[model samples]
Target: MLYVKIHQLSERKFKITQIAKELKISRPTVYKYLGMTYEEVKQLLEDPHRKARKLDPYRDWIIAWLEEYPHLSAAQIRDWLLERYPDMEVGESTVRSYVRELREIYQIEKKNIVRQYEAVPEQPMGKQLQVDWGETKQKTINKKEVKLYFIAFVLAHSRLKYMEWQNRPFTTRDAIRCHENAFQYYGGRTEEIVYDQDHLITVSENAGQLLLTTEFQSYVNERKFKIHLCRKADPESKGMIENVVKYIKGNFADSRVFSNIDDWNKRALQWLERTGNYHVHQTTKKRPAEVFLVEKQHLKPVSSLLSFESNHEQSITRNVGKDNTVRFKSNRYSVPLGTYNSATDNQVYIKIKTGKRQTLEIRKQLEGEIIAEHLISLEKGKLIQNRNHTRDRSKGIEEYKEHLISRFKDQEQGRTYLNEICLKYARYRRDQLAIIHRVIQEDPGWIDEALTKCLKEKLYSANDFRDMVQYFKNLKVAPVRNKMNDSKGPKHAKGMIVTTRSLDAYTSILGGAAQ
Candidate 1:
């Protein structure tokens, strides 16, 4: 508690003596904790310099040299100590033991300490936040027994919590995205954040030194926030966030039925406001939202960092295809007409940030103008197009009708038939015009008197019109005479007229002579 107050006072640029006087502590104690980060103070408290050793007098000096040159061998460290303390009475055995201890303790700047957590004192508002992820099997609308993952970031001071869910195991980029949202939800970020040595962040330890993954390291450098890594297999270190995760599962998600992921998230956000933040916290005896207003004062302003997410740099470029869309990964997203086509002869390159459940923004490469935006789909070969992109309806039937009229103006009957079909199937002008073209090409008079007769029945499909034309063609009239010079045949004289089968009145002879 004194350490935190001293550190806080130092952050406000208080002098060491002033902080000591204000907090009623000695000047030396204030100086000790003043410049140290939260992680460093946590490490110091976990493993203090309380052990008495035979080479205790030289421990500080030896550890300092070892920390400075971690590459130095034990023999080299011993020699350096001897040169500094020529009159010292420490033997080689005592020196070796002390050097080994120093390497184990002080060689690494930060060590992951493993121990059971004691009952922690309440932290001042906006001092720290604990972060962790929880997983559970949930059934969604289309998916059954899905592995649902949620990240919980709980403020140690106000007992305020923020939760975000994902359908998959979180990557380093996803975790950073979660942090960005959590900070935004809190309206500001805490001075320090605690984690459980997440594999996405921590790669591996090298000689007891906790090494952050390259991607996470870059993120940390950009964000510039303090990180406190908990000991392995130790949930008690970040007990608050762990409890919040459990509470979310039991109270919020246990009996809730999910219609879809989007609705579920919307309800979850509402639940956080209503039940999670509005209720009085058992520990703080105040509503988290109310306490958060006070915590907001002490918090580092969110404006100090970037307003948007930090891990959105991984982008792939793609050219716009002939369909006025750019294929990113496997799916295609629509852009404007002038953006890409043969007329311009210039390519529109779009940058794609790929992910599941991703909102893709299509920006112009040169101007950085957003041409289009769409929700990214996981399914391949999908063209995610917006109807507003190509909204010109007159470009189709109005323009094409003139061309058709000009092509067959000489055929007066065909032109009249085209006009009739267009007016009759006005709602389906495109389809009816296309069918008129096919009929004109195949058989000019196929839609002659029969079309006029069929218009009374009001048939509208292109296929039905085609089938009617074929039925008209099949109804060939029988010639009265099959003679060589039979120009005046019965069907030729009167011209053929088709008739439907009158089933009930048709006279049929049983053996050709019984009629």
Candidate 2:
């Protein structure tokens, strides 16, 4: 183009008149093509050559080397080129010009590549909001390590933003809570929320389709908000929030110090009110608060807050043996003796709440009757064993020796037998002989049943037998009566009777007893 040639000539130190005479055109015409005023041409002729150098054949090699080693200096590159071509001597200035040209070409190539991506236009204001998280560290009240997470929210149209920090680790609960807080603060709800692919909200991707987490989906559905997840590694898709992150980090967090997460968040809110809301955006030339006011008019009214409880319910079946002791998971838990009915063994439900940490809360019911309450064990992954199931195994052949001796104080034979039983059952401790004495005092009949059950079951301790006794006390001893008695027995039992009998027989045969 003529303009290109005019620019080249100007860079080459050609006078405007000289250029016009050479091209056989008027000076005004030459000036028009050059895109410069007469005064600009006068200044250009007085200056040094500003023409861009032509590309060299070896320039690509030089660029590749520099890219591989960015620290390489001009002198170093000159030496490298000389070594490659002994006869050629390239000046450092020429190498510099060539490097600059290569850099410009690369930038232009990158711009052209990015131009292929089309940006989606913004629609009505407050129709969508962007979400993200940033992190920093602070000292807690106890001077312990505390990593704080900042939830960043930005309006899609106006770029109005808010940030808050929490000490707890980010989870599905926190995600839902943050959305609730943002909606409350804004006094309205956007139809859609755009978010980076956070694992709490979006679980997995298959062929570019996002699978939302069950909890996250339910939360959004309750609020009537559509979710749009940006492509992975595409920060520009949510540029508003990304810019807000930079602004907050530089302006609010950089020089701030606080004793706790709450204090830091309070300070962040103050900073947002003072700086973020009032400042005019460089691109939009409107204050964020002003723009947000316009956008807020378009937003839908905020819905009533719904209960955001996590959904991690599970059914726990306690295994109770004939001895009346129940086994929870791997740990043995004991209830009152004759309190648990075998038919209701599986009715117990253990409610687990997983938040910043996992907590277990258990509820027990036997035929819909509340029998016992115990604190859930705090052991990490280890089942809590019931202490009531321990049984003493040292008692021997001299069963009622201590009792008989107590009645006849001077009976030597009874004393000897009592000592022998204590020695056998209590690891040769005379004190253990007193346990037999106490058992006789309570109920002598329980000793044999308890001992026989412990021995038969190979129970290791006296507590084990105790747990079994408790389990029996909680169970129903009465046999269930058949509701429909067959007068003809099974000769001609048909339909439901046959089906019920068959199912019961199959269950009994397979040892598959229901609760």
lDDT per residue as tens, model 1, 1-515: 65666667878999878876676555665666666777887886567575667677776776676566454445445444544565555555777666654553342422233444456778888789998888877666665567778888889988888888877678766787778888788888888889886666775554557677555676777777888888877777788887788778756675344566677777678778766676578767899888888888888766545533333454433556766688776888888543542322223434455676668877654335677888878799998988766634566776766655564424464456556667877886765566555554565455554454455456544445555666777785222322457578534323455576654445443333323
Clash count, candidate 2: 32
Model 2: runs farther than 4 Å from truth?
Answer: 1-120, 139-145, 307-375, 378-515
RMSD of 1: 25.6
Error of 1 at 214 (Å): 1.9
lDDT of 2 by residue, 176-218 (tens): 7788788887878888888887766775666777777656666
Best by TM-score, which number? 2
What C-alpha lDDT values do all the predictions have? Answer: 0.66, 0.59
Error of 1 at 18 (Å): 66
Least accurate stretch of 10 residues (summed lDDT) in model 2? 107-116
